[model samples]
Target chain A: MRITELFNDGQFVVTAEVGPPKGIDCSHVVKEAKEYLSGIHAVNVTDNQSSVMRMGSLPVCVAMKNAGLTPILQLTCRDRNRIALQSELLGAAMLGIDNILCLTGDHTRMGDHPGAKPVFDLDSVSLLHTVSQLEKGVDLAGNELVGEAPKFAKGAVVSPCSDSVDAQLAKMERKVMAGAEYFQTQAVFDSEKFISFMEKAKQFGKPVQLGVIIPKSAGMCKFMNNNVAGVHVPQHMIDALAADKERAKAGITSVEIAAQIIKECRPYCQGLHIMALGWEDKVPELIKLAGL
Target chain B: MLITELKSKEILDSLTQGKVFIINCHGCKEVSFPEKEAEEFEKALGDKVTGILTTDYVCNIDNLPLRLEKHAAAIEAADTVLVLSCGVGVQTVAEHLPGKRVCAACDTYALPGHQGVTPLEHECDQCGQCYLNITGGTCPITACSKSLVNGQCGGAKNGMCEVDPTMECGWERIMRKLKQVDRLDVLKCPIQLRQYNK
Candidate 1:
């Protein structure tokens, strides 16, 4: 099913994101995509992504589409200027790429090189506006483009755990006003926090896709706690798993800590964007666990 | 909270082509904490983050030369390493894995056990003989709650310190405990040498 069509019925969605490798290891990407295609309505291929470059998202997204699966094109404003952004949307339209997820990716300075400069020429909001412009048959500079424009059921990311409800929902409202038809939220570990956040998200009236990334192991929960911000995996889960480390004598695989979260938060989310990273094949097991 | 690199997508993207990176940490407590902090630091490090794995553990000093040979698969998986072990271990890891970016993830202040969390700013300055006994086993320079030299400062309010309401005045609590235990006379004894020789 096309993701746009899937959202129309809006029962429960299973979308996943695939990170393309920089090296010519399409073998892993292809294998992972095939694994994802069975249970997911659509798979998004991230662009040069967090500004740490990769083989561009468009080619792989088109490839996924070729493999008889819906693909969401994640276009970021980190590298490209407005000219590039508008042209790509039009190009995506030409290529039958209908689902566009717009982002103002990570700044260049945060990557490997500290001395590198940043290009924030267009933030995510402005990028959302640009996508709307393409839908409206115009360019970013207020000039109308020749011929028809591309139409996409655009979605923006909302990190429900990052800012205050007002701040996140305000952006959600703005993105919706700017033609964002859907929202894919950051990983939702605490369902109560998201339920409260959704009370505010309801004003925008767009579908919300929850980002569900299962932790790899016990150390990962602590790694996420100590490292990954915005998403808070409770201290109890980490401490519990750390305690269970001694129970390798039992049948408990370390990855089971993540499986617990899916069981916990399944009721609160509309759908989950399972990002199993390297463990893409585990998608089926997770979906089965969720009873999706 | 300690940031080695800030966020920038442009730099992050360019560095993805960089070779995989790894750091070995041999499961020591100090290395474990710093390794976590270092990995978090690496995540904030926009790009060029290939892979990070803290080593299994180290029991003896001599375990390096031969066991490091067994780490050929892990060593070959990266182009750089920020060793989270002490200087000796860093040198040991680097001595074997030549021509790789090996830096210290842990600070040089190698101390034992629970008290050393490595303050970004030094908390104490030992000016020779410690006066811990005079202040009830709490050094004025390090543990007076406010480092008040002569006595509890005005911030010391009614048994508790004002700077942190939960904390009793370092001097006040020390004095009360000594009096309660009939050790008030011991308050006059000067502290024994507490200079951190290392």
Candidate 2:
């Protein structure tokens, strides 16, 4: 089913992300998608996630489509300029990949090629706007398309745990204005903050998929807290993970935390965006644990 | 005004060989200035220091010449004029004092807030293409870890940036605001390609 249909259907949506391999091998991606297909409404194919070069999200998305799985094509502004991005959009449409998530990919400084030149010619907002124009049968420069324009379930991202609520809200407003029909938020660990954010986000009248990440260990939790920007791993969650002596047991605790967040934030959001962080196998367990 | 931290001693050493003249800015009082840092540099340079000139708002290129005129003789004696100010101050001094070797002793970093006032929790990158009007006054350019204009990235876990966990994600806030203002439709308008040259 289309992500939009899931949202409009008024059922709790379930989504997950899968990384394309650094090389051209499609077997792993295909395998992961097969594992996730039954449980998720759609799978997001990341484009060079973390600035690390990976197989293009489009090809992987096409593979997922061929596998009878819905795919959200993750497009980032970090690598492609407007010309390249728009061209790719047309290509994705031609391949019948309609679900697209626009983003400003992670900075090159964070990826393997720190020296690579960044091409943020158009940010996620601009990209979303371009998608809207294409939906209307025109290009960014208002050029008419010879054939039918591709229809899409345009989506964008949000972070409810923002330090500045006003700023975050402002960007969201622009995305919505740019024709984003749905939103998937950054992972949400703080229940209070997530709830408070939901109280406000509901006013937009759009389905927001709360992001959920299961930490594998205390060290992982600490690494996210220290290194990841905009993510605040609660002291209590860290303390819980650190309390476990066995790394295996700690992984269980991570699921418990994720399940707890899902349970708490479920009422406010329309769906859950589970970012397993390569722990794809655990998603089923997490969903069951959260009672989703 | 930009906040700057001193460069490494090794870098400073590589930039200067003979007599050195120091110039520091006391203009950006709202933010921390390297007062003790300048004192340390002065002590470290010892006999090689020709003179030290502390001026207010070295970025004010108009008054810099008059300030430098007073120290003309001392400036002429020094082989290198070292500026312990933000990039703007260093460039201003370099532009005015041609033929003399001008070097900056510090690098500037961004702070939140705008205008010539004390920075708060929000900052602007002045990326020429301002989305503030549609973004409910939040600048995606300055806020997002990647400054993504379209939306949030997959790296964001629990609403935190994969690159930095302590901070809240930028796009998350934008979504909430757009919903609040009921102007989510602005997102539908194609944002013209940004002009970075501005």
Candidate 3:
């Protein structure tokens, strides 16, 4: 079923994110998507995530769709301007890739090619409005479409960890007004904070999927705590994993933490967005452990 | 108001290999002015400084030209014109003294409020879309690192910013203030996406 339909049916939707490979090969992604097909509602294909150069998200979503899995094409404004973004959206829709997640991607300075020029001509909010305009069979310049307009299940990313909760709420409302049907949040490690965010999001009357990233190792947990923005790794969770000397045990402990968050956040959020973070093969195990 | 810190002597020495004229700004002292640093610049530069000119308000575009013209002879004699003021003051000097090797000696920080005076504890990015009325005068644009206008990012561990541990989460302050003012219904209004151009 389409992701939107799953939301409408009140089904607990589960989506997982996968970054495309650095090259054109899709065999690994196909394998991952195949594993995700049974347990998750949709697979969100990430754009050149973290400003790192990767295979484009569009073809990967197409590959996933061909593999009998619903694919949500994640688009960012870091690399494209309004014209290119509009054209790509139309192309993706024409190719039957319906679900699109709009994000204001990380600045290029954070990526592999630090010298690369950033094209932030439109942010995620602007992209959503442009997509809504396209859905009306018109372009941003008020130009009419030659044929049928593309129907899109628009989605956006939110971070409930923001210091400014009201500003975050205000931006969320704007995205909904601009045509975002659902929101997939940043990785959430705290349940109480997620519950409070949901109380405010519930007023928006839209589906929000709590983002969960499985920590692979104690070092990884510490790294995320130090580097990643809008990610909070509690001391106890890190300590629990740090106590495990072996890598295998550490991985299991991380999965257990994800399971705990899933169990706790399930009541407040309509969905769970598991970001495998290169541990795609382990997502099913995490899902099973969470009893989703 | 902009806060400026004088460039390191190593950088200044590298930039100005020859004689240079210094122009200091005594503008907007209510916020901050580089008084001690300018005094040290004179002492450090010694004979390298051909001349020094101080303007009451270098940011005053109208009166600045006449003030700078008064030092035209000394400025023309020097090989380079080094400005020890905020970016605005530097630009004003550069605008008046065209065709000169003009460079800044200070790094200007982001301005706080409308007059650019008083570096505020709380800032507004002036993203062209203001939600202050609903947010109880708090601006999410500057308070939140991600500039989220909807809800918190859920990364805060204990009422602090996930990105910066020492900082309070912008949303937490907003929520508390909203409750205090009893204006929680503002969250119900479906704010339209920012028209950035507007």
Q: Pick the candidate with the highest DockQ.
A: 2
Residue-level error in angstroms, candidate 2, position A45: 0.6
Off by over 4 Å in 1: A113-115, A246-260, B1-198
Worst 10 residues of 2 chain B by lDDT: B113-122
Tens-place lDDT digits, model 1, residues B1-198: 111121234433333344545555545454334445456666765455555555644223456556655666655665545455443344445434444434344433423454222322222232333343243333455544434333332233344554455666565644544444354554323212222342
Chain B TM-score of candidate 2 stands at 0.57
User: Pairing residues by index, what is the TM-score of model 3?
Assistant: 0.66
The digit string of per-residue lDDT tens for model 1 on A26-83 reads 6668666886555678888888755576788888877777877788899876677677
Model 1 interface DockQ: 0.01
What is the DockQ for all candidates, taken in turn?
Answer: 0.01, 0.17, 0.16
Whole-model lDDT per candidate? 0.59, 0.76, 0.76
Query: Which scores better on lDDT, 1 or 3?
Result: 3
- Cα error, residue B77 of model 2, in Å, equals 48
**CA shift at B107, candidate 1, in angstroms?**
48
* Deviation (Å) of A95 in candidate 2: 1.0
- Alpha carbon lDDT at A228, candidate 3: 72
Docking class of 1: incorrect
